[model samples]
Target: MTGTRTVVRHAPGKLFVAGEYAVVEPGTPAIVTAVGRTVTVTVRAADEPGVVIASDLVAQAMRWRWRGDRLEVCPGQDGPRVRRAAAHVVSAVETVARLLAEHGLPAPQLHVSVSSDLHEAGTKFGLGSSGAVTVAAVAAVAAHHGLELSLESRFRLALLATARIDPNGSGGDLAASTWGGWVAYRAPDRAFVLDLALRRGVGEALRAPWPGLAVRPLPPPRGLRLEVGWTGRPASTTSLVAGLHRRTWRGSASHQDFIKTSTDFVNAATDALETGDDGALLHQIRRAREELARLDAEERLGIFTPELTALCAAAEAVGGAAKPSGAGGGDCGIALLDAAAGHDIAHVRQRWAATGVQPLSVGPTPERNQE
Candidate 1:
């Protein structure tokens, strides 16, 4: 790595298009995008091979090193399943180390710090906080070690690192946080990269241009609004993803049919955005959510808590259609509310407070949601 000090700030969490569960189905193309909350990673060289921590993730300082295919984790204690935690840390380090080597840079003696605005314990939002942190960490480490990687290459390495740990992992969250905003990633074989350009509007309005301008010929939509809520329950995304693959491989014909229909619905939803037809888009959104429910039922996914269900109903009753965000047992939900409903979005959020899940008021950022 080249620089002495490097800081990488990455936005947290993501929303999916189709294939929330199917992403683990190996070839399924999952659509994901970055949101407002973010985690920042700052890296500096240390004299030793130990890792110092200052994040809500773990209490004690963590240390580890690359040991071939295995990461040798030294957790400083046998305190209650420290082994497992160390394993995760080691896996992350190994993958990141390989990524740096792939770019022809040596790993530096690193001091890393991470901070996020998302819920601490519920970092279980199943939006891949671990992977996001790993991405930021890798970026910081690479910069410190003097390696320069293309943005696409960085995302690719992060995904590879994450997969080395959780093979059933969806590359969505890594892509979302690294690239930011809506991305329609086709299956890996097709190598299709569709830029929604959702960030341009916000960028122009703020008089700041987004980074990573590749000059893709895509036009931004006119106006848009999104209402996001929490389900108040966290999901074991790895398990859920594994289950999805198992079920899909079992050749449940009905599930196969459902996937096709859902893909079509999602495609229609995307088409609605291009037409500047919020009315049609809202309808498509509702249809997509309904299709997601059917798929979730088949996969036995989205087991919402009572509070989450109540919140969903409440949002629907208030001129919106609500759906769980990630692979859901509940981390959060998104409600694409119609602007004509005359319902104050703020007031709607207030109602959700009784359920312990606060509504997040989000707007496009200058970074990615460009026109």
Candidate 2:
């Protein structure tokens, strides 16, 4: 938006390096990394009252009004009051407005414009686009209101907005988007967090000690080349997680085993990253692939598809380690290889092309580690 007063912010998308389904539970450790792809949010003061959020991905800009401490759709809009298209944007505005309200400030008029490069020809690469968008929106909106939030505060507000939309998220992607490099993340108890926010206020909730939330930076690989492959189809993390939730496996011993095994290796992988143990990291990647395969077998979650299988097989054939990146029914996968082995990398790409997998030229976002 071109306006006298405006703020723009960018947040990078993320891919899960290791740790998946089990990370949904509070405090479960996971490794995630920020990618070069990003979503940009531009916030400008509106000419009149109310708010309008327009996304390049969506057809229409949604209008909303502040009803006390919340945002409600203006009467007679194209879609319903709460739309799936701009759900993250809506939640972000409401959450930040609540925070402003707690500080005795009136919610200002806004026009939030969003643009994202996380997709190819309108198809998502499954690189946590929602998380990136939320993070960017929260930061831009807060800044436009003259609120200079610390990294921790901005992350907290983003997570709160995310939880308000869907409490089942692990928030690891948010950590990657906020921090801009490899990170080891643990989720907070969302139910407790939402309740605290509702009862007390955003200011108090921001100050409260979240029981299981943690985020730490991990060292980058010294000699491994990270390659991403897209399956040309998008996968829904929500549906995959919901399928797991529907099964009566939460307290099952096998489920407990899955959690335990995933946690152990993710912790080990963190250590390997710290020590620059490329071989050990490769071992953990293989281990993670096996664990996800086992979980799929036990739960019938369809976590793996033929394309993903080929993607992994091709990586292994090229003397590399690979696995499905996230929920991975048909989204994206990651592989690590010797940085100098260009021939092997080309062969791997050729195999992926033969199997209908598209290798994406994505790398870690060029930025320093978060302090």
Q: Estimate each model's TM-score.
A: 0.80, 0.96
Model 1: lDDT of residue 1:
34
Query: lDDT by residue for model 1 over 206-265, one digit each (tens)?
Result: 123223222111122344456677665677777766776665444678767766766676
Best by TM-score: 2
Give the Cα-based TM-score of candidate 1 against the true structure: 0.80
> lDDT winner among the candidates?
2
272, model 2: CA deviation in Å?
0.7
**Residue 314 accuracy (lDDT) in model 1:** 71
lDDT of 2 by residue, 204-300 (tens): 8889999899988887899999999999888999899978888899879998999999999999999999999999999999999999999888888
After superposition, the stretches of candidate 1 with alpha carbons farther than 4 Å from their true spots are: 1-3, 26-30, 78-92, 102-107, 121-127, 187-223, 302-304, 340-342, 362-371
Candidate 2 lDDT at 137 equals 90
Model 1 per-residue lDDT at 122: 30
Worst 10 residues of 2 by lDDT: 362-371
